[model samples]
Target: MIPQTDPKAGYLAQRAEIDAAIQRVLDGGRYILGEEVAAFEREFAAFADARHGIAVASGTDALILALRALDIGPGDCVITVSHTAVATVAAIELTGAQALLLDVDASYGLDPAQLEATLNAWPATAARPKAIIPVHLYGQAADMPAIAAIAEKHGLAILEDGSQAHGARLNGIGIGHWGKLSAYSLYPTKNLGAIGDGGIITTDDAALDARLRELREYGWRERYVSAISGMNSRLDPLQAAILRVKLTRLQVDTDRRRAIAARYDAGLADVKAISLPRTRPGAMPVYHQYVIETENREALRTKLSERGVSTLVHYPVPVHLQPAYLGRVPLGVGGLKRTEAAALRVISLPMFPQLSDAQVDQVIAAVRASV
Candidate 1:
C-alpha cells in the first residue's frame, strides 16, 4: 500500500546515512540535550534565518514556552486565528491567558481585516491580549505585513505559528523570522519530520533565547540547581540526529512538493467545484498537505476513500468548539464566518516530497472525478 506519501520515503531513499547518524547518537553516552540537539538547533535556526534557536519536546510545548517566555499569563488575552490546530489556541489557554479567535482570508491564513476590526471594536478591555499569534496555515503564511502593522498600532506582540511550514517562505524571507518567536513541529509526517515528537522556537532576541534554554531544563543552570520554575521538555538526541540528516535536503524536498503542487494547479484547473490554495508572489508553500476546499466535502472525502486515495481534514472543528477549551476561550470574535466556512470545506490530500508526479496525477484525477 502507498500509505500517505511522506518525505520519510525520500529520507529512507537516503537511509544508510540516516541510520549511521542515529547510531552515532546511540553510541554517545549523553542522550537528551546533547551535541546532536545543539547542532540541530543551530542548523535549524540558521535555516529559518533566526539568531537563536531552542529545541523543545513537542509543538505544544514550543507554544507554551513561547507564551511563558513572553510573560503572557492569567488575565491576559492572545488574539489569533480560529482556523488553526487546537494546539495553537490550547497553548494560550494553557498559559492561563484567554484565547481570542479571528477568522481567515482567501489565502486560508489570518484575515487581517477581520482581526483589525475585532480589535477596533473590542479594544482588549481588562483582558488586553498582550500578543497576536497567527498560523502559517498549511505551509501558507498569513499576511504578516498587515498583521505586523495592526500589532504595532495595538501594541501587541506577534508570535507566528509555523508548525506546518518548516522551510516555508513569505515575501523572500522565511516564516520563523517574521515575528519575535515562531513555533515549529517536527512530527514524523511534517515536511522535515523527526523519528518522534520534537519542536523548536526561533528568534533573534538573545536574552529570550538564553532564558528559554534555561527554562526547558527545569530552570536548571546545572544538575539539581533550580534557577526558576520550568518544565522538563528537551529534544532527544536521536530525533535531533534524524532531523539533522533530514535538514540537509529540506529545500530540495520543498521544491519537489512545489512541483507537484504546480502539476495539480495545471491538471486540475478545470475543476470548478474545487478551490486551490493561493501562494503570494514571493512566498513559497512547502505543500505540507495540499489543502483544498469544496462544497460537498463529505461526499468528496467518502468518494476519495472508496477510490483508495487517502485524505484528511487538517481541522474539522474551529478552536472554539473543542470541548477541552470550553469556558476558557471566548466564544470567538463575532461570527468567525471564514473560520467556520473553512472547517466544513477544507480537505488535506496526500502530500509529501516522495509523492511522485504520477501519484499527483492520480490524486488530481480522483479529485476531479469526485467533484
Candidate 2:
C-alpha cells in the first residue's frame, strides 16, 4: 500500500550523499555538539534568514528551550491553538506556564479575531498573558501580519511553532522570521527532516541567541560550570551531519511537494464530498500533509485503504477535547468551534517529495473514485 509519508524514500533519494556524511561524522569521533552540528546550525540559520540557530534533541525540546530563553515560566500564560500536535501545548506546560487554547480560521491557523476577543475578556484574576505561539500548521502560515499587530498592542511576545513549515513564506517574509523566535522539528517525516529525532530554533536577537545556547546545555557559560539551570538537549552529531546533506536539496524537495499538492488540488477540486486545503493569498505553503476535509471522513479513509492507497488523520482529536485536557484547558470566547469540526473531518493524503508522478496519479484516481 502507498504510505502516508515515506522518510525511507527521502533517505534513499540521496543515499550516497547521506551515507557519506554519516561516515564523516562517525570518523570524527567528536559526537556531541561537534563540528557537524555547528555547521548544520549555521547552514540552517542562513536558510531561515535568521541570525542564529540552536540545534536541539527533538522538536518538543526546541519549544521548551525557546520558552525558557524568553523568560516565560511559572505564573505566565501562553496563547495557542489546540488543533495542533500535542507537542505545542505540552512544551508550554513543560516550561511551567499555563496554555490558553484558541481557535483557527478557515486556513487552519490561529484566528486573529478570537485572539483579540480572548485578551479583551481575560479574567482579572488569571495569570498574565505573556506570549502567543501561532503554529504554522500543515506548512501554511498563520496570519502573521494580523497576529503580530495584536501581540504588539498587548505586549505579548511571539513565538512561532514552525514544526511543519520549513521554507514556507508569507508576503515575501519567511514563516520563522515573523516571530521573535521560531522552532522547527526535524523529525523524520517533516519537510526538511533528519534521519533521526532532531529539532532547531532560530532567532534574530543576539542576546536571546546567547541565552538559548546556555539553556540547552546545563546552563553552561563555561563547560560544566552550570551558570544557571538547564538540560541536555543537544542535537546528535550523526543526525546533524545527515541533515546537512538533506539541507542541500531542501528547495528542490519543497518544489516537488508543491507540485504534488498542485496535482491533488486540480484532481480533487470537483469532488463535492471533500474540501481541499486552502492556501491564503500571498502565502506559499510547503504542503507537509495536503489535508482534505470531509464529513464522512471515516468512510472515505476506509475506501482509500481498501483501494491500496494509505491516508492518515493529521490529528484525530483536538488537544482540548482529549482526555488529558478535557474540562481543564481554558478556551477563548465562543469556544473552539472551527477547531473541533476540523479535527473530525480532516484527512491527510499521501505526501512526500519522493512520490513518483505515476504514484501521484494513482493517489489522485483513488481519491477521486472514493469520493
Q: Whose lDDT is greatest here?
A: 2
RMSD to the true structure for each prediction, in A, is: 1.6, 0.8
Give the least accurate 10-residue stretch of model 1, judged by summed lDDT.
Answer: 325-334
The sequence of per-residue lDDT tens digits that candidate 1 reaches over residues 95-167 is: 8888888788888888888877778777444655689898988888778888989999988998888999888
Total clashing residue pairs per candidate? 1, 0
What are the per-residue Cα lDDT tens digits for candidate 2 across 164-259?
Answer: 999999999999877789999999999999888999999999998999999999999998799989999999999999999999999999999999
The CA lDDT of each predicted structure is: 0.84, 0.94
Q: Write down the TM-score of every candidate.
A: 0.96, 0.99
Candidate 2 residues lying further than 4 Å off, grouped into runs, are: none
Please identify model 1 stretches exceeding 4 Å from their true place. 7-11, 123-125, 326-328, 331-333
